[model samples]
Structures are given as C-alpha cells and as structure tokens.
Target: MTQTVPQTTAGADDIQEIVERILSAAALPPIVQAGHPALRQRAAEFDGQLSRDQLDRLIGIMRQVMHEAPGVGLAAPQLGIPLQLAVLEDQFDVDPEAAALRNRSPLEFLAILNPRYAPLGTGRASFYEGCLSLNGLQAVVARPESVLLEYLTPDGAAEQREFVGWQARIVQHETDHLNGVLYIDRAQLRSLSSNAEYAAHWAEAGISKAREGLGFDAGPAGISLD
Candidate 1:
C-alpha cells in the first residue's frame, strides 16, 4: 500500500532518471500519486486509434489495478494516462441507515469515456469522500445531489444518463480528474482526517456529528479543529 508522491515536478531529465530507477516495473502501471503532472493537466478525449481489442485490454488492466486499490472509482489520470475514462461500482448491502444517510447504494460496474455532466436539480449534499490517488485521507466535499450526463461506453456508443445521490458524487469525482480537479481542491479542509480515524470515530456519528466534531462548520472565529 506504500507509494511515493514526488515532492517536486519532474523535468524531461528527471523523468528519465525516474524511469531508470523503476525500470523493473514497466509492466504493472503504478497509480501516480498527487503532484504528478498528469493528475494536474486536463485529460484529452480518447484517441480512437487503439483498436477495440487494445482498448479492451487497456480497460481490463485498469479494472484489475482499480480493484487492487480497493477503491469504488478510478480515473485514467490516476494511472498517468491523460484520457477521459473512469470505472466505478458499489454494493448496496452495506448498513442500510449508513448507506441511505451517505447516499450510497449498489451500482453495477460502469466504464465512462469522454464524460460530461450538468446539474439535475437544485439539490446539494455534503459527505466525506476519498480518492485513490490521494490515499489514506478523507474529507467532506459538497456537490450537487444529482446530474444529467453524456458519455461513451467502451464501444464508443454515445449515451445519456441521470444519476442521483452517491452515484452522482462518484461520477463528479472521476470526471473532475479528467478536468484536473481533485476532491481536496473542493473539500472542506477542516473535515480532513485519516481514513482510519474516520472509520473509528466518525462513520457512525452521522454527518452532522462528524461535521461538528471535525470542525467542518467552524468559521474563522469559531472552535479550533485541534
């Protein structure tokens, strides 16, 4: 589970040095942590050059890596590939109240290419969120509760879909990567906490309790987070 986030941006020479250092790991693509150039630069629409078979293989590998991270969703930029693609799924069998409270539910694995989204309604919600690239951390991110989206399937068939609750949040999160935005960029910094701390102390407390305890609503003149 250990990974490194390069402290400084790399130059062409630095990239060569990095490549030489990890030459043995050419096959298994590493999930690039935050601070890498790819995670910051907006991704491009997928070039249709890769044949369907090649695209399938690429998607397969990405799926395997995503599952290994044990994350519900992942984007192409996370793997250092600047393409508009992402995959995600969730199980509805988690605690009912918890799932309902957090707007999470079962969802079949889905892949999205060249995705775009617009608000579905005026509803907004806030819940703690995490990212694979920004591992070990969680924070409260406020986003629209639902969205209308357009994206391509793996086969390049265009489609429109509507999503609500946690599903919408996941979609927004992944698509944000394609636009060079991380949850942290929109997160309530006061709510930041280690995943372990969140699970141990905040998970069952409910969002309001969690927010109060984490100083999420504390203004500049309010209670100290520490």
Candidate 2:
C-alpha cells in the first residue's frame, strides 16, 4: 500500500510532532515518492552529527519503518531525510519461490552509512529491481555480479567487504541512493512491469526467459541473471 505525507498545511514542528507520535506509537511514516526533491538530490554524508545514542535511536526507527513498509531496503531519502543512510533485511520466508529463483537468500538486518561500491570483476547480471520511492513497479536492471563495498557501520567503524550474488545487488541498490540514483535510471524500460504483472509474467520464468521476453541479452554463467 502507498502512503503520502499529509496534504494539510502544517508547520515543521507540527510535522515533527506527528513523526514522533508515529514512532512512539503505531503508524508508518509516509514514504517519499520518486519525484520528491529529496530523492533527486545527492544525500549528505552522515558526519558525526548525532550522538552515538541518537544514531542508535535513528537506526531503530529506520528499521521499524523498513519492516512496516514491508520492503527489503529503505534509504533516508525515501523518508525525506537527505543523509547517507539505509537499512535492509531480505526476508525470504514469504516468497520462497521468488527468492530461490532470484538467487536471493535471507539476509540479517543491516544498516550502512555513507556507502560506496565498485564492481569486483568484469562480469555483469540483470534482475528485476524495485524501489520504495518508485512504488508498484519493477524493472530489469543490469548490475555487476560482485562488488566491493566500503562503508561505515552504524557504530562508526569503517568496513570493506566483497559481496556476490543477490547480496551484491542489494548493496549496489542501496548505495546508489547515496548518489541519488534509482534502479529505473539504469533499468531496461521495455522490461518494466508493475509488481502484479511481474508476478504474473515473470515470477516463475528463469532469468534467461525474462531477458529473452524483454529483448535483453543474458550474461555468462556465474554472472547469470538467475
């Protein structure tokens, strides 16, 4: 389901109070849409602004919003916060078929700050990707099969790690938000489909079939789409 910020005119403090209430009680914040000014601009680095305890609280709030939105990942821009932060947790239990077909396994909750990534090798892959900011639609986006990511953990520790398969895709997708990029910007528009249409037409089809169906060429073995 889609959510929107309230339409009524209100002051900043009023909005802040509402957001606090939602966090303290039982409501999910409205996810900002694609054309929202915040989503288009590059996110600011999360310098040592908020205290450690404050960062911890923000993480908790973001995780809650991510789970409540029922999305695998969410970025700060999606909530109108222009900071380089994101949260992700790939829960595969509900759609085991899609998960297995997509080579996506369950992932523990992860929070990354000021993230950046580079392709690990020359290999590439394509897969249907969706964004909370661009709700209801999924598109085929070509991305590197493996990537080396550099980022600061929520606790401010620097980390450098390599990820392959679906994990790599997740990192690429989230980190792109730091630069104000969306999957759709790199996706095959002809392969676009609404979420329901995606389930109907390509959910069970292997990556090759979907690629062929959408007129895209598939890559070699390890970097295989599926």
Give the alpha carbon lDDT tens digit for every residue of 1-226 in model 1.
2223222233434433433333335565788999978787666676574457656766777777777877778887787766677887775467778787877878788999989989887888887788889889988887889999899999879999999998999898898788777888777888888989988888772568787786676221211111
Evaluate residue 70 in candidate 2 and report its C-alpha lDDT on the 0 to 100 scale.
Answer: 79
Q: Which stretches of candidate 1 lie over 4 Å from their true place?
A: 1-27, 218-226
> Predicted candidate 1: what Cα RMSD to the true structure?
7.3
Best by lDDT: 1
Distance from true location, Cα of 123 in model 2, Å:
1.5
Error of 2 at 73 (Å): 1.2
TM-scores of all predicted structures: 0.81, 0.80
lDDT scores for all predictions?
Answer: 0.74, 0.73
Worst 10 residues of 1 by lDDT: 217-226
What's the lDDT for residue 70 in model 1? 77
Output the TM-score of candidate 1.
0.81
Highest TM-score scorer: 1
lDDT of 2 by residue, 24-76 (tens): 65656688888876676666677765557656766788888888777888887
